[model samples]
Target: MADDTGHTTPTRRELTGRIGVGLVMGLCGVLFVSTARISGGESIRDESGSVAEVLRERGRTISDLTDAAASKRTRIEELTQGTSSSEDRSQLVADAVGLSAVSGPGVRITLSDAPTSALGSIPGVTPDDLVVHQQDMEAFINALWAGGAEAMMLQDQRVINGSAFRCAGNTLLLEGRVYSPPFVITAIGDPDAMIASLDSAPSVKVYREWVEYVGLGERSEPLDEVTLPAFEGSLTVDVARTG
Candidate 1:
């Protein structure tokens, strides 16, 4: 179609089709970007949620172990009171040990700072080095169990299954309080066997070196009877389901 200037203009149908195509392309681009952003955000949220879940599970496991230990102790006490026969007593004792091995006839280990000469010979004993660390305490407790401990305790705090032995800046954290030297860890087990096992353990022997050189702590007072406290903690396990 020629206009007055002999130039042709676009037909109405062609202009409408061009406009519709442009609108469709713009909509598709917006949708693509929005989908990408949403997918990335969901990925980050999923990762964070997974990490939180793992930590929760770990906490629950620790709690359950503590509760189980406590329950076992209570059951043993009941059994001991209900029967007087030698067989019954023996069975009760066995049950108690099974719940959480208690040590008997064990030795008490007291930790403190060493003499000036001893401290000077090695790395200067700091507050951190003076007291027992959680790992050391755990090693000692584990060794006692291996050596047939009937029960164990650190001072008045019972070393239960849930018992946490942590050292922060020379301060001992047990159950829920800060303890200072001389930090005493008592175990009830065969005195000879416990002592031998402790003396032979690499961890104990290492600590013993600290004792000889830095006087980290000393072990003594082998008693015929030393009772350990029962476990105290929660018992619920929170599990995740996969489908």
Candidate 2:
């Protein structure tokens, strides 16, 4: 408020008014940001719709796809029966079936959300902190894959190249089926390496922190012999792309 000639500054009242305006503006900015963040979070929470109906439709589609894949495989086998490539055909069948069920020494992982009573007693802990999430499962699965697992099963369903797992609220959606905790994962591979990978995974590390502090579920064990069943669901394979 000083002039070029270094005259006296504005009165105290004027400076106080300016400071008040700045504080108000700052508060408004903070409120805007907070409101936006809350709205964005609410949108994500509200967007998922009618889970039961969606799962039912998905199950129907998978059943149809399974039937079609079986028919296609049978026709292919008949056509290639006496061909020189019969061995290749047999190999294809073996790989497909192996993806469905593999019996060998491997590792087993079991994870579940903390009990409701434990969650309630923890200060500063939200409900989200007490539940198993999709990311947690993905991180564990990816770690096993990196450890060179030959095959994997989530619950009783085999994991395929096209397999995708998702969660709505706390329920897991896998291969058109819904599952609740405790979630079990079986992977056929070098148990030592798979366990090591789980120990080193970054997401698993974060999950373990929660496990320690907030009581989320976590357990891994090696199995002498385990067999996973074939994936009974159908997959829609798209081969063509359009621009």
Number of the top lDDT candidate:
2
Question: Model 2: which ten-residue window has the lowest total lDDT?
Answer: 93-102
Model 1: runs farther than 4 Å from truth?
Answer: 1-104, 115-127, 229-243
Q: Over all chains combined, what TM-score does candidate 1 have? A: 0.50
**Per-residue lDDT for 120-208 in model 2, tens only?**
68888888778999999999999999988989999878888878889887888987677788899999989999999998999999999
lDDT digits (tens) for residues 140-220 of candidate 1: 777777777767777666665545566664556564445665678787778888877877789877877766655666666
Clash number for each model? 11, 1
Worst 10-residue lDDT window, candidate 1:
229-238
Q: Report lDDT (CA) for all predictions.
A: 0.66, 0.84
